[model samples]
Target: MSGIPGANRQAPKPDAEGAGSAALGPRPATLARYLTIYAALWKNSVTREMMFKGNFLLWIVVELLWFALQLSFIGVIYLHTNRIGTWTQWQVVLLIGASHFIQQIYQAFFLINCTNLSELVRNGKLDFLLLLPVNTRFVVSLRQVDLGAFLNAATAIAVMAYAARQLHLVLTAGHVLTFLALCLVGVWIHYSLMFLLATTSFWTIRAQGIVWGYYNLFQIARLPDEAFRGVFRAVFTFALPMLLVSNVPVRVLADKLDSSRLPLLLVGMGVACGLVSEWVWRLSLRHYTSASS
Candidate 1:
C-alpha cells in the first residue's frame, strides 16, 4: 500500500492474490528499469502535452530560439577576436556546437529524467517509486520522458556534422571514436552536475540557480580552455569543470588535443557525482517529512 498524492492518505495495497503483486518481482535488468521509468514518464508527458497543443508548438519555437541565441553569442565573440583563446573560427564553432550537442542529447532523449528530482521531492510521490520492485535510481531517473527536447538534440547533432565539414577536418578512426566517447562523457558530466544540482532542491525546495548557473557555465564552452590561464583554469578544470562537459569533445575533434584525460575525468566525475548525489537522495529520504501517509 502507498499514499495517494494530494489526499495524503496511504492507498490500500493490492492483495497478494492480485496479479500486480504476484507477477511483479525483482527485475534482473537494472538498465531496463531505467528505460521503463522513462517510458512511463514519457507516456504521462505526452498526455500532458496534448492538453495544450498551442503551447507545445510554442515550446518547440522557444527551444529553437535558444539554439539560435547560443550560435549568435558565438558570432558576437568572433567579431571582437579573430581567434578565441587560440582556437580558430572553426574550432570555436565546433566547441559551441559540441556544448549544444551535449545539451541536446539529454534534452532530446531524457526529458523526464530531468524533471524527476523536482517532482519526487515536491509531490511527496517519491515513496511510490521506492515501493517499486527495482533499483530506486533507475526508477527515479526514468520516471518521465520529453520528446521535444529529444528532437532538439537530434537537430544539434545534424548541425554538428555540418559544422565539422565546414571546418575541413578529416577525422581519423581513432579521433572519431574518441570524439564520440568525449561527447558521451560530456553528457554524463553535465547530467551528473545537474543531478547534483537537482538534489540540492531536497534542501532548498527551489532549483532556480542550478539551471541558470548551468547555462552560464555552458557559455564558457565556447572559449578554448587555453584562454583560461592559471587560477581560473584550475577553477574550471577541477571545481565544476565545464572542460569535460563541452571543451574536451571539441578539442579532441579539432585536433587541438591528442591526448585528453577527458574520458577518465568524465568517468571519475560521473562516479563521484552519482555516488554523492545518490547519497544525498537517500539522506533526503530520511529527512523527508512526507505529509502523505
Candidate 2:
C-alpha cells in the first residue's frame, strides 16, 4: 500500500493543474495591483467600444447636440435679462459647462460601474467578482469606461474656455489647478451618492429607476445657487448638496465666492458623502443573499 493517500491514483493533467495554480496565485498589494487592473479595464473598455464604431459615433454626436441645446437655452435666457440671480449669461454658461464636465467624467468612469451593480446583484453575477483574488468593491466600481462620454467631457472644456473669455476671467496656474481639483471633488460627490443609490439593489433587487432619479437632481447643479431660496434651497443645499457641486467651483473660478468658507464646506460635504456611501455599501453587502441561496 502507498504511504500517502491517493499516491497510486492517476495525477491530474499538467495543463489543468498549472492553470488552476495560476488562477490561485497570491494576490498583489492593493495600490499597485489596483492601478494595473484599472489600466487593463480601461484598455478593454476602449477596445470593446471600438468594436462598435457606429454606436460610439452616434453617442458622441448625441452628447454634442445636447450640449449645444443647453448653450442655446442659456442664450435665450440671457436675451431677456441681464443676470439671473447674480450670475451673468457667461457665468451661467460656465456653471453649465462645469456641470457637464463633472457629469460626463462621472459617466465615463463610474456611472456604468455603479449602475451595473444593480444588474450584477439581480443576476448573481456579483458572485464571480466576489470570488476573484482582488478587492470586490474596487473591481465592481471601476470595471468599464465610456470613451464617448470622455469625448463629451473634452467639449465641456471648450465651453468653459469660451465662457471665461466672454467674462474676461484671467486664468492663472493656481486658478486652473483649483478649478480642476474642485471639479474632481464634484465628480467624487456624484459617484458616492450614485453608488449609494445602486447599493440599495442588494435589498431591492433592482434599483435602476432610483439611481436615475437621483441623477436628475444634477440638472439643478447648472443653475445658480443664489436662484434658490427657503425650504427648497435648504433641502438640496444642506441635505443633498447637489447645488454645491458645480456652483462652488464656478464661484472659485469667477471670483464670485460669497463666503471664504464655501469651498471648505463643499469639500466637507464630499468627504461626508463618500464615507456614508462606503458605510452603506458595507452594510448592504451583509444583506446580500447569493442567487444560489
Instruction: Report clashes for each candidate as comma-separated counts.
Output: 8, 0
19-119, model 1: which lDDT tens digit per residue? 24324634333334445655776688799878888987888789889888877877887888888767777677677777777777756544346555666
What residue runs in model 2 are displaced by over 4 Å at the alpha carbon?
A: 1-29
Best by lDDT: 2
Once fitted onto the true fold, the runs of candidate 1 whose alpha carbons sit more than 4 angstroms away are 1-38, 109-116, 208-212
Q: Write the per-residue lDDT of candidate 2 for residues 93-200, one digit (tens) a residue.
A: 999999999999989988888888999998898888876655466678879889899889999999999999999998899888999988988898888889989999
Scored by CA lDDT, what does every candidate get?
0.64, 0.82
Q: What TM-score fits each model?
A: 0.79, 0.89
